[model samples]
Target: MLNVLSVLIGLFALLFMIPAFLPFLGIANWLLVPVALFGALIGMLSTRNSGRNFCLLVAAFGALRLFLGGGIF
Candidate 1:
């Protein structure tokens, strides 16, 4: 279940990239970072290493987007 959640969250993170190109989307893009982070946290607590790593990667991507775009901080 956690693995599935991680994959879903990763996919969502990928989708979050779309807003980067569409400026009209506004702050909606920033919301995905927390969701990705939540997934990473859940993955970290799970026994599946693959899911954990995948989620961590997603979290990294989300963080990169947020940092580069200056969405937060």
Candidate 2:
């Protein structure tokens, strides 16, 4: 159940970051970072894993955005 939720949150983050593909949506794609991080934290607290998979997923998503050159930094 918790694992499922974590995956869902990760997926949603991926979706939210997709807006970067639209020209007018420039800068807006940055917002997905926080939204995804929030979801990841929620999923992390709800999960029973020893390792922080949620945090890792969030990092990966952020990195993906960064690698795509869509980061605010």
Candidate 3:
């Protein structure tokens, strides 16, 4: 249950992340990072690792975007 919830939340964040890749819209990821983290936290509770890994991957991508954008686009 928790894992499912985590994956769902991560997907939600990913949806929002689409625009965040825009040259000047990277700031949106500031909001997405926490959401991804929350999903990761929830995923950590599940016995399986798929959900946790997915969320973590999302978070990492967001972080990389932020880095490339210099923390604020």
Candidate 4:
């Protein structure tokens, strides 16, 4: 149940991530990281690692975007 919930939250963050990936939109990743991290937190409470890993991957993408774009694109 917690895994499912965590994935759902990750999915919510992913919706934002898609748009944030566009050029000139990298700044939005600042918001995406926290959301993905929150999902990762919930995922960590679950028994399975899939959700947690997925959320972390999502967060990594957000962080990478912020780093590459310098927080504003």
Cα lDDT tens digits, model 3, 21-50, are 999999999999999999999999999888
lDDT of 2 by residue, 1-73 (tens): 6556666766676676566545555455466666666666666776464223654565566666565664543
Ranking of all candidate structures by their TM-score, best first: 3, 4, 1, 2
**Could you say which candidate leads in TM-score?**
3
Which runs in model 4 stand beyond 4 Å of their true positions?
Answer: none
Worst 10 residues of 4 by lDDT: 64-73
| TM-score between model 2 and native | 0.52
After superposition on all CA atoms, how large is the RMSD of candidate 2?
4.0
Candidate 1 accuracy as TM-score: 0.68
Answer with 2 or 4, whichever has the higher lDDT.
4
The Cα local distance difference test for each model comes to 0.68, 0.59, 0.94, 0.89
Best by lDDT: 3
lDDT at 43, model 1 = 79
Q: What would the per-residue lDDT of candidate 1 be over residues 1-73, giving only the tens digit for each residue?
A: 8877887786787677566545545355467667777777777777886766776776676666666657743
Each model's TM-score, in the order given? 0.68, 0.52, 0.96, 0.93
Worst 10 residues of 2 by lDDT: 47-56
Off by over 4 Å in 1: 21-26
Q: Judged by TM-score relative to the true structure, which candidate is superior, 3 or 4?
A: 3
